[model samples]
Target: MQFDRKDKNNAVLLDLYTQLLYPRMVEEKMLILLRQGRIGKWFSGIGQEAIAIGSTLAMEENEYILPMHRNLGVFTARNIPLKRLMAQWQGKLNGFTKGRDRSFHFGTQDYKIIGMISHLGPQMAVADGIALADLISGQEKATLVYTGDGATSEGDFHEAINVAAVWNLPVIFLIENNGYGLSTPTAEQYKCQNLVDRAVGYGIEGVQIDGNNVLEVYDTIAAIAAKIRKDPKPVLVECLTFRMRGHEEASGTKYVPQELMDAWAEKDPVANFEHFLLTENVLNQELIAEIKADFKAGIEYEIEAAFQEEEPIANTIAELEDMYAPFNFKPNALSPDAPSTEVRYLDAITDALKIGMYKHDNLVLMGQDIAEYGGAFKITEGFTTLFGKARVRNTPICESAIVGAALGLSINGYKSVVEMQFADFVTCGFNQIVNNLAKTHYRWGEKADVVIRMPTGAGTGAGPFHSQSNEAWFTKTPGLKIVYPAFPQDAKGLLLAAIDDPNPVLFFEHKYLYRSLTGQVPQGEYQLEIGKANVLKEGRQLCIITYGLGVHWALAYMDEHPELSINLVDLRSLQPWDKNAVSNAVKQTGRVLILHEDTLSTGFGAELAAWIGEHCFSDLDAPVMRCASSDTAIPMNKVLEEDFLAKSRLAATIEKLLAY
Candidate 1:
């Protein structure tokens, strides 16, 4: 099997050729499989194989690369087993995501490859997080993330690059300018001369390379990577390439002009690289045939093995169990009998964050103006001085970037708590929260151990923009834990527990209760169970189920009406709300009323009422009712806001239920 090439360059050339040829052969085989219905889909990287092969091979083993769906060569160059990759493509149990995701949608930490989600630009931000983790740990590692000419137009692309540039994190923003984005040509995508030209706006170096030339890609990327490691900074490298095939097998390239296709065909990466190697005598006709034959046989064998592999079976319990990592709620540093101090809900949260920082060194706090300015609510006041800027990081006003970065940090052995200055502002980063962070665990078994602190609820007359009880939006999304605490003790305990949980937990802190609610809180570290509901008052006449500000309103209503005995349940966690406690309370009281600050229609209260009606039907003396804010935006006027909230209607709703 030995080749009679004496030149040292021969070995390097052969390695590059083999790496380049493997993915090409694999893609060709996969395309055939797709036509035969053996595989579901194929995103051919036939012409652009050189870019992936060269750039990936140029990086050090410890460094990370986030590849898009088109970069099949990145996986092969990293030497990931062909069989497992085939299994993944075939949706088999042996795959990286265990058939949960297809193709490059899954990331493998073992190989230092962070996979891309469907939203292409978010991975760029994720790369920033990885590089930030390395920088924080004093490692000279760099991250390389890929995007297309089309994805460059996405807001995340700008946010990611701008943040990376500002922080001087070592990152390579590789744009594969493949001319077309699902049939939309580059002419329609942007007005810029080249994708790399946009890099100047972010204050970063920009370079354009002929992506068809593997040697150019390798040399350019290798040099940039070395320079980045020595002096950390972000660089934008645009690989001028073309997609030789349709976006996917199903999408035909009828819109592509015949002449354009013909022109690009002449610049075939695999054929050109082979011709170069042959001209240099590093490879001959016989050697090329042997290499292609070997790759084809290996790919065929793996494909056959992947076909034999079992499809992932749907097990309800196991699937549910896989949604989150095992959460171990730690015992309190102070015993239950220990002396407690009264503090505002805001101070309790601050204390918990401080304790969390002391406990978990890798815990990072990220938000706008959270460091020096002490945040909008001043929850992290003096945090930068106390914990240093590294841990208590003040991020730019880029929610999507920070949220995606938090997921990236979670990927690399760090727990992050992202604070939305206001809960309403979370809509800006909704995709990162619901799609990326929430689905990461279920899709790839990569737990996003991030806590998003949402200062939620209305009553401050902050208007529609600042005041919103938006917990109901995320309760519908699976794989996310939503924790809304009503009191100071619960706020501290639930937040600490959320920080410890190995999943993305949305911790809702009511802006109204932050300073108003004062209660006896344990002085030291303590974490309450996340999904458990606490009963504030025990009664049998009627039951009220609520969380956050609703708990306060219900408590006050019960205090005003002493004759109406009520069982008040504070559902601390919405996603895994205490169903058993709610059902038991309903059965005990024989009447149940669901309440929340969110709008009435399709709110979390509606869900609770439906569950109570379905499960506790026989025990109910009256129909399960709900009291929530009117279906309208929170108004700025204090009187209108009061009227809009469920608090004004709570007594009437409760009395009506009791009377029934």
Candidate 2:
């Protein structure tokens, strides 16, 4: 195994040996600390250091690498100050996530490292996004993303790889097949003979390498990276390695047989590489001792510094501070005196998207059938010809991957607007939207400037799947803005505002209002304040608070009953709803009615009613009333739907509230 001194890769072998040794020593120290109750937990990459070190170092400096919890070598190889990383593990204020998260759950843009969330397979799709950004920007950069053998079974893994292969994206899907995922063995995870063999179905090149061999990993990944940068297609590399320790320090390795552990210990990456360096005369016993001593001292110094740092305290005000990035809404952009034209609600959204594309060069649109087919509702018709296929991408029916990719794009200085063919389908991508996109900024200060276009609400008898008002689901999740506009003008203006805001937004477009609703929209591009509500009419008897279809229902009910002097308020944004406007209107009217298209139980109206009851209880002449549909699945029959809708009983509820 000894290499000749004349060998050109001699220096590289020495560097690799050092990189592999660093994480091994760091993990050993952390495990000792764990046993002493100093640190909380640690996911040891004791035996699999070669995969993280080799794969990360193989990529170019500007390229991105999405590392998993066990990829400690990736962080250390990039030379991220060990003190900062130690502070992160200690839950100190100076950590990458500011103590919002612990371990390798945080990412840093400065190092081109996107960290992994607990959900394993989503980052694979996110890597596609980073690679897509590089390709769109005409940069020859590739993205390297890691996953385990068991996680390869996740739907997101397949979706991500398939999309990257179809689009010829420059992504390296690195799988560390460590034989087990926690306690579940690979035999129980998938039926495939070899994990790398799955690449054939994807029509991509697949390579199987002995992950314990640092030299092999480095050489194979370096070659693949070079090939991908030139050709720009995905390649799957399965690194056959073993987990020498438990999933976490606390989790024992009782399930692993002793013979298997003994077999893997012989192939220890750090020891094996060290032996080779020693045998090659590149390192003597003294030099090896010196390197270990130096690294140990450095780690101890960093850990001490981290211990002296301040721990983050949980404060209500501080908790809400970084939930969203600063967004300035310019009301003057409305241009009320500009030329205007009548357009449908759907057309207004299309116009706003067109304006956004023209305005922001880095803005990208992704969804199923969004490019040539113009999306499920023809909202993006002619967009492909106007904007090109790169920006307006037609993704596979993989909601999770698409949403994850949007977050990845946002991480790399791009704004993304994702279209869900139907709002109900967002359930497939729920984890990405709620966990990844919603928590990115709060956890790591990375703004997910993503807008998910949800064509929601029921009226057209599209059945239970297609016709559900699901805004209430996302309304409960913090760090997300929910905008549901009723009129065409509001839809256009609100959409533009959502695009401009540096936060994840759920833009719910009422499917029923697509062609049925029409209004005069200003010709010039404009942005409206998302958190601001509009007073459609001012009255003194009772206040009707609503948004989306409820706004139209209230207006129609008011038209039918001219005697009811209603103070109608349209709460366009649900997350940061116009609380002041709602309070003011409730005080003015003395009686308030909350209306929505969602089911009665746990609908967004319930929240409004609770808030009004809490804040404006004294102003109310009567108890707060909520008018909503019964708690039942949306029926397919139009007749049944009409009876099921809240609109059928809106007038009666209004009468009851006003009479109170």
Candidate 3:
């Protein structure tokens, strides 16, 4: 392709010329700093500046951009202030994340740019979520997601793209296929001639373009953006380019051949664009010199000035703060004269969902077999028919994608209550939960108001895969609230409370208690206090501190032995469990027994016991004791399953605590 300054939109092309120059200049500056030991490390997109700048130009101010480390160029083109970027590189308090993170992994929500995680491809699902938010709201905006050729190999790439295609979401997936994913070449990554060809499997429009050509990239993205804005469907655009430098400053380019390097260097996007502009006489070389000089001066000043700023403080107390969003909500109080119905725990959950959906117009439910099939437990039996499939969705058998998409969806003013089919399967989405959902609020003041309904606890002879009490996995996570209900009323009320809370909540509905427990629940909408515990029975001999199915087990033990008066306390919320309630019970009984269905080692019971020992040491008449399942997989046999966490075991533990 040939370029004539008079035939082209010179103004737009000239602007792109300057935008491309910023990243190139920053890359050069960073490489020098890396060598000088001023910066820790650097990941440069030196050769492929055109893809970053050109695609950014095509996006509107309102559209969202999820940028990877290499796409720092996108930030520069969006005018994100070189000073902040420099300060971030230096770990200064003035930087994004307040120097909590050091690189392109930080972004301001106001900028509509989501920072990337070190783990690639998950953000694709997140971006789809952001786009889905707009589609559901009937907004006229598109989402532009950036990924590298290497990320295309990730499952998230397919999971996200498939959802976007099926929903006809307004999103443009821009892949920077720079010939190499780290050190592995394209031939080894996939057999496909081009990355865009793979998009056909997802049933979306796919296009391949010369990533080195600034005008071609800019024009291609501009058209893709326009098409998605109207028809609201996803498009995949693969930019064929190369990385001139190593993967990062540490990864030297010894694996890259000099011959290939020289060939790519000859067609460098920044250099080639400059030559094209100069040859076409686009306002002469003098103006270009001024623009370069101005950018260089500004970059130099920011780098120097940022160094003089205060180093980010390392305060453990402050860091721990803001881990969870404020748990505050005006519960829709149940009417005094409202009717009560004796409902099963499963029906109570469904009732909560129906009521929540009726109350909040933006509530969405997604999980495998949740819509038409009514979930694996039939908890959502008639949800699709009642609330319609759009609100109650059946997603693919991708746990990570479901959670990732829900995280994205929550960012756009919608509340998502996702089901994990089985609680054991939540491990598949652990990365998204721990890294993305748990840290999102702490890293940036963004809340993913998502509720993951986990059918947890072990009792059924469903073996290791189906039976698991994994509540302990998320108890250590900062930004997540965990609710484990033992009865029908608490199940329904706590779920409603979780759905209303503005942070991610892991609602654990004990599968064992789903049908076994039946109690009269309030007819109208009502939410029990989330972080508070409930004392089902009062006693003076011992305090049984437990929750979920453990509460029922404690009650059964009480029925068996009326001789030992025990105070059964349900710590409904694990993360912010009721310390005050536990303290009061311990003070009265002077003997504490912490029990749960999870394994003994590093379980939630351990935390509870530690807390009691720390805060209620003098109040305890004896050492804090706990009875939990052994640190092994839940057994498939009925005899072993009962022995693992049976009422008999808890009864013996209570008797021992009493004697002590």
Candidate 4:
């Protein structure tokens, strides 16, 4: 029934009367379930049901809504099946969380709505990201993030809000200011009594509405959404309501005074809305009884189904367990077939990037000196010419911001290539890369298709921060691909592969080899690939595993020491490196030597050596070995720089292998 604009009383009666009743009934069932041990805990949306329903009803179906644990009404209204939801609450196999995610923390890939999360702040940032994507991709759908007033104190909340405001993201932040954050009230927590007022600092519109009045809440939200969908700015709506129940089903009762509870209970939203409905004749007592009965039966059906569902199998739940992909640093494999066309490794990389950028409009490039300077090494000198300034652009020295913004951009339907001036500088943006970009897809099942190009490994006299070999640091980060290219042709192929990947990829281009390494690469649109190994040579006596510039050195070593038969493998992709190829070569030949330019303490070489030793234990005549730099910072001294690198130590390690 429409809340006829003509009758003021009819508005509350028809629109919010049932909304209020449904939430109260749901809460009652939630309490019963808690008593029966069918649910672990419950967050009551009790006194503010009208506001919850009103704000939620304002959104389009395709538009995204991310709610906290207290939003059962929103999830149920959105059609998230009650049985699956109850199963999740019961920690059963058929739970909406697929028996993997925590009860009350649910996510659905099919529906746009994100599942509830115990972790408060991340959802705010994630909601903004979804809106950013919609804005960039030209998608009509918007997004809303629902959080309590207390959550505003979080750094992630501020960070997300600031960025969203600055970028004019199509998002709405709905704050349920239900009097307190558990034991503490909003006044004690924040200096500003109004949460909406906080938006003034971020340069966006902020509004406060009466939570008990469903029509007011709905109209306010609808107006804001309309303005936001047109202008696409972040808005904060502070709902003035009260929480009738304790923070949890059985907790917070000790802290909350009964007198205060009585005060809050007197203005009970369900009764207020029901009275309004009756006053306007939108509904009578008989209809109210039937509505309660229908909701009662629905809740009963859901509870029964939760009990009837079968236990989840181990393996199916295991898929949810593996959101964090394992990292195997160096795979046993040969280098990619020498570039078919004669070209430098940097040249192949440039070709691959340019081709991919042109082929897919979503690909974009950003770095400190990339635009006018065309990058420090000038690899991207003409990238802007081909891809245009919008696609190929430069950024400030804010490494953290660059990586964070790129992550924000990726969710918006763009594949970003974020270039750190040097591999050593990745430390600056380490948090954003690992915590945000790397784990986004893992936690939320959201894709972050972006490439981080860090010019790595020490060889030149660049020294210390500029010349550290930090591939192992990134390889340790799960859900991120690490690719190290040695030759020009392989550079083009692997880069092509990284751009096409849906996962975040860390492309560690060797600073020393950018210009020095040369090979054949097709000038046009071909790509090599990521996740495969290149066999530089096949031998019977021993197998040598190397990557990046080490591949060049290994090839040169083989050429000089032909009397010793050693198969060489250049692993192009470090994260998902070719384990099969490496193990196969180790199986073929009993001897294996892992080599890298990084330090020996915890380098990729050590990982490779361990894997080779494990899988090929009986196949080997001798123990596995690694030839890498000592555990020390890259020296500033030109002469000592070369000495400190794996290059100087490599010869001796090779001799040790031959002697054995």
Number of the top-ranking candidate, with lDDT as the measure: 2
Residue lDDT tens for model 2, 1-660? 222323446677778888989989989999899889998888988999989998888888788999999999999999898899999988899999988898999999999999999999999989988889988998888899999998998999999999999889999999999999999999999998999999999999999999988878888888899988989999999999999999987788999999999999998888878887877778889988998999999999988888999988789887897889888777746454788899999999999999999999999999999999999899999999999999999998899999999988998889999999999999999999999999999999899999999999999999899999999899989899999999898899989999999999999999999999889999868878898999999999999999989998999888988887889999998988999999999989999999999999999999999999998899999999999997999999999999999999998887788677
Regions more than 4 Å wrong, model 3 = 1-7, 331-338
* lDDT (0 to 1) per candidate: 0.90, 0.91, 0.86, 0.76
The number of residue pairs in model 3 that clash at the backbone is 0
Q: Model 4 — which ten-residue stretch has the worst lDDT?
A: 325-334
Q: Name the regions of candidate 1 deviating beyond 4 angstroms.
A: 1-8, 333-336
lDDT of 4 at 551: 84
Give the worst 10-residue stretch by lDDT in candidate 3. 1-10
lDDT score of model 4?
0.76
lDDT tens digits, residue span 1-660, model 4:
123333345554465566556667868888887888867778777787867677778788777787887777677666677787777766677765455566556556556666544547666766765676677567766678888888878665676777677667888888888878888877787998688899899898888987767777778887788888887888988888888878886765667778978887776666766666677677898988888899899879977878898876768455643554333233223346532567776777777778888878877787888986799888798777776776776765656656765765666567888888898888877777777777666555667777999888777788788988889987877778889887776777677767777778999889888777776665555555677898989998888898887887888877888797788888888887899999889988888888888899989887888887777888888888888887888898989988887778777887787679
The C-alpha TM-scores of every prediction are 0.98, 0.98, 0.96, 0.83
- 1 against 3, candidate with superior lDDT: 1
Which model, 3 or 4, shows the larger lDDT? 3
Worst 10 residues of 1 by lDDT: 1-10
Predicted structure 2: lDDT? 0.91
